[model samples]
Target: MLPEKTDTVVVGGGQAGLAMSEHLGNCGIPHVVLERARVAERWRSERWDSLVANGPAWHDRFPSMAFADTAPDAFATKHSVASYFEDFARQIDAPVHCGTEVRKVRRVEGGTGFRVETSKGTIEAQNIVAATGPFQKPVIPPVLPELAGLTQMHSSAYRNPDQLAPGAVLVVGAGSSGTQIASELQRAGRRVYLSVGPHDRPPRSYRGRDFCWWLGVLGKWESKTPPVGKAHVTIAVSGANGGETVDFRRLAAAGITLVGRTQGYDNGVLRFNADLVANIAAGDANYLSLLQEADDYALREGLDLPAESAAHVIPSDPGCLTDPILSLDLAEAGITTVIWATGFAQDFSWLQVDTFGPDGKPQHDCGVATAPGVYFIGLPWLSMRGSAFIWGVWVDARHVAQHIAARHSQATG
Candidate 1:
């Protein structure tokens, strides 16, 4: 029975939600941001202690506050990023009602806006921004669900290698999270198995220089995209196809075994695609060439190259005549743990809003949904290549904010 009137009600107070909140405030738009947990709850509850962003530290900055420069160049951990987000909310005086869970947000008749119901109160806004973002849910594939015998955990739950059950581990998905976690588990004296697959454009440099340096130069650390253009350049950070860099040079140097692509798991046995690595490597030369092209483009444009980012090396595992279904019987093999770094999926069920597309994502072009007065921010590529990276969301945010202002003018007119 709480108050039920506001210009806008933004659900979820994560990076995107907060960014939008700040922009709306600046535009003199009266709005409230409702967060189920405290601000950036996912970052506080989910991120790991040793988690250094794969990108760079500069991109972590937000629109309101400059990412302070104590450890500016390095990948700050979850806590560091979370603290920054908290400070950002305070700086903007964002009307973020913490602990308020949005149970439902239904678009009112005429699609003019939504009726937002939160835990503490209810609100009706002519415009609603689904800034909740896409990282709350953990995507555990059905294939691995049946393997109850093996002690399993997702990347989100992993804090340190200690959380793992024990013994040799089968790590699925080679994205940044998977690769970093596997490296840690291996160092902890566990037989680590890395399952590889396809991934998106692995940017060698952040902008014109090393990716890290480019974060500062291109300001991608805090840029935002609207939606349409962002998806085109930046790929989902999810550990799909295989974001795990073949950097076989490092794995070979570390003596890590390249396992088959995981297809599924039954009882305790794991199934793997035998030729995933070979197939990926064959095409990897092409991806590397693309990176080289990007590098040349940067040099031509006089962009600053990232000096701190590692020089990625392609794997040496060559010639897959016809190998497939590589299985490792963990129990017989004495391996006890299985870490599923297998990417993530978006969960909008709690939203209760009928604004999603066929893919269950907010249906928007360049951050503007057909539902009018509604928008999206901080998606992987809401605008351009760097949209979702730490700095990328900034660019997307500004554009979305501008659209909101224009819509506001029309509404109040």
Candidate 2:
């Protein structure tokens, strides 16, 4: 039962959409939240079974609601996170229409409003909030040539080691997801080859404080988006195994084969970039930088904190750095599965508006798009470094909702 008209329509039912709905309700703006599946569908279905929140439970939740059952320092599992969002939606009384897929959104002819077509029915709205979040579509690079017998899948589709083909696994991309998956596969007795990439390596905790806590205290979450030409790299830290630093050297020492970035597949063999050593060194530098920042902050504030020893600070070079694998034959090494943990791409094809840039990304100032009445939320660095997280989504949602309210008042007044 879709409404014939509404003041606004939120095009997602994940954390972002639910947050937007909460703020809209607070402002007394009538809106409907449309979700393709159940609320927080990605967390419910897309994530790997072993996945946990990278941030601790306390910091990862909405400000108004706490993970009452979860320990403050403990990381909530993916199932818990999904349930948390669903519970929050219920608590806020968000009008989320699950199983309602938004097929297309286009400007209504000769009108200031827009028309949203969904699987259930059509809805006319004055504003549209694209809360589709960051991870919309999985991105698998075309570097590897397709083999007839090879099993391939993205990290999003991966569940557990048992789900993969019983053979050696090649996990491409050294981000948190890739590393975690590769480590899990190796520990599960599969020979794992992890493709190294440029990434920031932050310790899960420092001086009895979680990395997220450090970020909050240091005001790093308030950091703005990178300047033009600079890229934002996600930190490779994990809350698995009761929280631990994501050190490649340690992973390699534990028996995972380390390799350079995947280049392309040559005649029946896969080639990789000869930059494994450089990538390792860069990750080490980022790790050290964080340690240094934390140490300096403690000293400046005269806070008593445990100091890391010099020997502990420097990690021994792994064998992979000295003897990097540049190429490999899948058949020769008995590799059967290739997991692409590369990343995801934005899919706004249904959004028929001129709000996208040359890179196919939404062109917006914060959440407000270039196109009138079109807005975006749940994007990384949308407002700050925290924009993609739970608390940040609420902040940005409130801002967007306020803007919409102002616009509505101006139009109706």
lDDT of each: 0.66, 0.89
Predicted candidate 2 versus true structure: per-residue lDDT over 259-318, tens digit per residue: 998998876689889999988888888788888899899999998988876624666777
Pairs with steric clashes in candidate 2: none
Range of the 10 consecutive residues with the lowest summed lDDT in candidate 1 = 232-241
Q: TM-score of predicted model 2?
A: 0.97
Output the number of the lDDT-best candidate.
2
* Candidate 1 residue runs with Cα over 4 Å from true position: 1-3, 109-112, 145-148, 200-208, 212-246, 279-283, 298-315, 318-325, 352-354
- Every model: Cα RMSD to truth: 5.0, 1.3
Model 1 residue 23 distance off true place after TM-score fit, in angstroms:
0.9
